[model samples]
Target: MTKIFIIAGEASGDVLGYRLMTALRALRPGLEFSGIGGARMAEAGLVSLFPMQELALMGLAEILPRVLHLKARLRQTVQAIAAQKPDIVLTIDSPGFTLRVLKAVGANGPKRVHYVAPQVWAWRQERVKHFPGLWDELICLLPFEPDFFAPHGLHPVFAGHPVLESGADKGDAARFLARHRLGPEAVPVVLMPGSRVTETKRLLPVFRETLALLAPHVPNLAPVLAAAPGIADAVAAYTANWPHKPVIVRDVQERYDAFAAARAALTKSGTSTLELAMAGVPMAVTYQVNPVSAWFGRRLIKVPHVAMINLLAKRALVPELLQEQCHPEILAATLLHLLRDDEAAAAQRAGYAEALASLHAPEGTPSHAAAKAVLSVLG
Candidate 1:
C-alpha cells in the first residue's frame, strides 16, 4: 500500500483536501492516508494528529497569543511526518503550518507537495524568494497563479478553482425552502461571517445589527447563517440573541441549499465569495482583522480588492466593506441595494459569469486534475 500523508489547516482546506483524497483514491485505491485534517477529511477516513482547529488561525494579532502553541504543533507535525515516512507528503494550504512542515521535511526527505499555493503574489511578493526549496511541487487553484510563480522558478500545477465542482450551483432551492419551512415570500439571505471562530465572533454581532437595520425594509427576511464545519454549536450559541435567529446550516449540502435559496449574501472575503458567485448569489464582502493586523495589512497588501470574484474580474464586481468600512449600517445598506436593485444584481451576475469561466481546469474536474498532478509527483 502506498502511504500518502495529508494535512489541511482550515475549513476550506479540509474540503479541498477531502475532494483531493476522493479523487486520489479513485486514481489509486488502497492508498493510505494519515496526518491532519478536519471533519470532512475525517469523513474521508483521516485520523488527525491533533485538532485541526489549532492551526485554523489567521491575522497577525489573532495568531500572536497562539504563537508558542503553534510552534509546538509545528514541531509535533514535523516529528510525526518524520516518523510516518510516507512516500509523499501533501500539505494543503495553511502555509504558516504546512510550509514549515515541507521545509522541515526538506528536499532530502519524502517528496513534498504543498496543495493550495499561498497568496504570496497578492502581498509580500518578496517572500517568493524563500519558496524555492520548500516543496518538490506546488498545486495552485487559481488560473493566474502558475504564471505568477513560473517567473520565480516555481512551476505550479493549476488544478483550477475547486469551487467549480462544489455543487454550489446545483442546490435545490425548493427543497431548501421546504426543509426550513420558509415560504417563497420569505427573503432568504445567507450570512457567512467566516469559517474561523475569531471571524464568526467578530462578524456575527455586526450581522445581527445589520439584520436589525434591514428587517423593516425586507419583508419576512429569513436569515440563514452558513456555519462552517465543527462550529454549529458555537454558531448556535453566538447567534442565540440575534434580531432574528438564523437557520444555521451545518454541512456542505445544507450550505449549498442555503446558497440556492439566498437572495443575497453578507460574507467574509475568501472562498465563500467564489461559492456564492458560483451559486449566482449576489454578495457584499466584508472582513475585519484587529486594528494592529489591519494597520500592517494596509501597508503590505498590493491588491485593490480582497474578494476572489473581484480579483478574478480584475475590478470591483462586488462591494468590499473591509476593516473600518465593515460597519453594520454599511453592510445593511449594501445588502439592501443588492436586494432591491435588479440592475445592480444583474450586473454582478454578468461579471460573475465572465470571471468564473476562467476557473475551469484545462482538463477534468479540479479534484481530478489535482489528483493527476499528485500522481505525476509520485512518478
Candidate 2:
C-alpha cells in the first residue's frame, strides 16, 4: 500500500491539508495517510501524532521558552514517520515546525513536498535557498511566489488561494440580519480578533475598545464577532464585559455569512484579511504580538504592510495598524472612516475586488492541483 505522511500544525494549515487530502483521495483511492493535524484533518483520515493545537502558537518570544518541548515533539514526529516509511512527506504551512521536521526527515533522503509557501516574499528571503535541497517541490497559494522562488533555483507551483473555493454563502443579507435578531436596516460591522488564543488575548481588548468608540457615532451599527471553534469560550469571556454585547457566530460557514452581511470589518491581519477582501468587505486590520517579538519583528521584517489584503494588492489598499500602532483609538478611527466615508470605503472595496480576481486559479482547483503535485512526488 502507498503511504503518505502529511503535517499541518495550525488551523489554517489543518484546513488546507484536509482539503488536499479529500482531493487526493478522489484522485487515488486506497492511499494510506498519517500525520500531525487538527480536527479537520483527522476527519479527512490523517492520523495525528499529537493534538494539533499543541503546536498552534505564534510570536518568536512566546515560542522561545518552549523550544525544548517543541524539539522533543518534532523528534517524536520525525521518528514515527521514518518508521512508517511513507512514499512522500507532505507538510503544510507552520514553517518553523514543518521546515525543521522536514530537514530532520530529509537527512534520511525521503522525498518531501511543502504546501502553502512561507512568507519569504515578505521577509527572510534567504530562506528560499533552503527549499531546493530540503523538498522535492513547493506548492504556493499566491501567484507572485513562483517568480520569487524561480531565481533561487527552486521549482514553485502556484496552487491558487484555497479561500476562493470556500464558496461563500450568497443568501439574502436581510435573512442573515434577521436570523441574528438584527434590524434589516442595521449596518453590520464584523470583528474577527483571530482564531487562536494567543491572537485573541492580544487583540480582543483593543477590538472591544474600538467598538466602544464607534458605538455612539454609528447607532445603526451591529458588531458581529466571528469566533473560531475551540476558542469560542475564550472569545466569549473576553467580550463578556463589553457594553454593546456583540453577536457571536461560531461555524465557519456562519462566519462567512456574517462577512456577507457586514458593511465593514475590524479584523486581525492574517488569512482572514484575504477572506474579507474576497467578500468585498471594507476593513481595518490590526495586530499585536508580544511586545518583545513585535520589537524584534519591526527591526527584521522588511514588509511595509502586514495585512494580506494590502500585501496582495502590493499597496496600502486597506488601512493596517500593527504592533504599537494597533491602539484601540487608532483602530476605531480607521474603522469609522471606512464605515462613514462612502468614497474611501468604495475605493477600498474596488481594490479588494481586483485583489480577489488576481488570486483565481488558471485551471482546476487549488486542492486538485496540490493533490496532483503530492501524487507526483509519491510516484
Candidate 3:
C-alpha cells in the first residue's frame, strides 16, 4: 500500500486537502493518508497528528507570541512524517507553518510536494529559487503560478482553482432565507469576516459598523453572517450586542446560496474574494493587522492591490480597504458605490467573468492534477 502524509492547517486548506485526498483515493484505492488537518480531512480518512487549529494562527503579529509553540508543532509534524516514511509528504497552504516543516523534512532528503504555490507573483519572488531544493513537485491552483516557478528551475503543474466546484444550490437559498425570516423583497448583504477567531475579532466590528452606516440609506438591508465551522460561538458572541440582528448560517451549501442571492458583500481579503467573484457578487474587501506588522508589511510587500479580483485583473477591479483605510465609513462608501451604480456593478461582473474563465482546468479536475504531480515525484 502506498502511504501519503498530508498537512493542511486551516479551514480552506482542509477543504482542499479533503477533495484532493478523495480524488487520490479514486485513482488509487489502497492509498493511506495521515497527518494534520481539520474535520473535513478527518472525514476523508486523514488521521491527524494534532488538531489543525494549533497550526492555524493568522497574521505575522498574531503569530509572533506563539512562535515557540508553532516551532514545536512543526518539529513534531516533521518527525511524525519522517518516521512514517510516506511515499510523499504533501504540504497544503499555511506557508508559515508548512514551509518551516518542509525545511525540516527536506533537510533529511525526504520526497515532498507543495500545493497552492505561495504568492511569489505578488512579492518575495526570490523565494521561488528555494523550492527546487525543498520540494520535488509544485502543484499550483492558479494558472500563472507555474510560469513563475519555471524560471526558478521548478516545474509546476497548474491544478484548477478549488473554488470552481463550489457551486451554490438554488433551492437551499430560498429555504435558508425563509428559515431566517428574511422577506422576499429584502436585499441581503452577506458579511464574511473570516474563517478564524482572530480574523473574526479583528474584522466583524468594522463590518458591523459599516452595516450600521449603510442601514438608513439602504433600508431593508438584511445582513446575514456566515459562521465559519470552528468559530461559530466566537462569531455569535461577537454579534450578540449588535443593534440589528443578523442571521447566522453554518451550512456550506446554504452559505454559498446566500452568496448567490446577496446584493453585495463586505468580506475580509482572502479566498473569500475569489468565492465572491465566482458567485458574481459585487464586493469591497477589507483587512487589518497589528500596528507593527502592518508597518513591516507595507515596507516588504510590492503588490499594487491585495484583493484577488484586482491582482488577477492586473488592476483594481474591487476596492480594498486595508489597515488604516479599513474604517467603517470607507467600507460603506465603497460598497454603496458598487451596490447603487449599475454601470460599476456590471463592469465588476465582467471582470469576475474573466477571472472565472482563467481558473478553468485544461484537462482534468484540480485534485486529480495535484495527485498526478505527487505520484510522479514519489516515483
Candidate 4:
C-alpha cells in the first residue's frame, strides 16, 4: 500500500484536496492518506496532523504576528514527512507555505508533487525557477498554465478547473425563483463575499451598504448571499443587522440556482469569479487587504487584473475593484451598470463563454487528469 501525505492551506485548496484524495482512492483503494487539511479533506478520509485553518492566513502583513507559529508548524510538517516516509508528498496551492515545506523536505525526500501550480505568470515570475529542485511534477487547473511552466523546466499537466467538474455550474433559474418565492421580474444579484472568516467580516459590510444603495434604483432587486457550508450561521449572524436581509443560499443546488438567477454579481476576487463566469453571470469583482499588505502586493503583482476569469481571458472582461477602489458606492455603481445596461452585461457574458472555452480540459475531467499525473510518478 502506498502512503500519501497531502497539505492544503485554504478553503479552495481544501475542496481541491478532497476531490483529489477521492479520485486517488478510487484508483488505489488501499492508499494510506494523511495530511494537514480542513473538514472536506477530513471527510474524504484524511487523518490530519493539524487543523489546516491554522495556515489559512493570507497577505504578508496579516501573517507577521503568526510567523513564529508558522515556522514551528513548518518544522513539524517536515518532520512528519520524514517519519512517515510517504511515497508522495502532495501540496495543493498555498505556495507561500507549501514551497517552504518543499524546500525543507529537500531533493532527497519523498516524491514531491504540487497540485495547482503557483501563479508565477501573474506575479513573482521567479517562482518557477525553484521548481526543478522542489517539485517532481505540477498539476495545473488552467489550460494555459502548462506552457507557462514548461519553459522553466517544470512539468505541468492541465487538470482543468475543478469548477467545470462540479455540477454546481448548472442551474434551474425558474425553479430557483419559484422555490424562493421570488417573482419572475425580480432582478437577483448574487453576493459572494468569501468563504473565509476574515473575508466575510471585511466584505459583508460593504456588500450590505451596496445592497442599501441599490434599493432605490432597483426596487425589485433580490440580494442573494451564497454562503459556504460550514460558515452559513456565521454569515447569517454577520448580516443580521443589515437594513436589508439578503436571501441566504446554503445548499449546493440552491447556490448554483442563485448564480443562474442572478442578473449580475458583486463578488470577492478569487475562485468564485470563475464560478460566476461558468454560470454566465456578469460580475463586478472586489477585494480588500490590510493597507500595508496591499501596498506590498502591488509591487510584486505583475498582472493588470486580480480576477482569475479576467486574468485567464487576458483582458478585463469583468470590472475589478481592489484595495482603494473596493468602496461600497463604486461596487454598487459597477454592479448597477451591469444589471441595467443590457449591452454591457451581454458583452461580459459573451466574454465568459470565450474565457471558459480556453479553460476546459482537452480530454478527461480535473480529478481524473490530476490522478493520472500523480499515479505516473508512483509507477
By TM-score, who's the top model here? Answer: 1
Q: Is candidate 1 or candidate 4 better by TM-score?
A: 1
TM-score of each: 0.98, 0.95, 0.95, 0.94
Could you tell me the lDDT of residue 211 within candidate 4?
A: 88
Q: What are the runs in model 2 whose C-alpha is more than 4 Å off?
A: 169-172
Candidate 3 lDDT by residue in tens digits, 1-379: 8888899999999999998899888877899888999989989988789989877777777898898988898789888987888878889988888887788887465688889888877776676676667777778888778887887877688978877766632325676677778788888888888888788888888888988998888888888898888888778887988987687878688888888778888888888888888878888888988888788778778789888778878888988889999998998888788879989888988898787678777768767777777777777
> Sort by lDDT, best first: what order?
1, 4, 2, 3
CA-lDDT, candidates in order: 0.91, 0.84, 0.83, 0.86
- For candidate 4, list the clashing residue pairs, or say none: none
Q: Which candidate number maximizes lDDT?
A: 1
Name the runs in model 1 displaced over 4 angstroms. none
Q: Candidate 1 or 4, higher lDDT?
A: 1
Candidate 3 structure lDDT: 0.83
**Clashing pairs in model 2?**
none
TM-score of 2: 0.95
Tens digits of per-residue lDDT for model 2, 134-175? 788889888888998878766788878888877553535666
Give the range of the ten consecutive residues with the poorest summed lDDT in model 4: 356-365
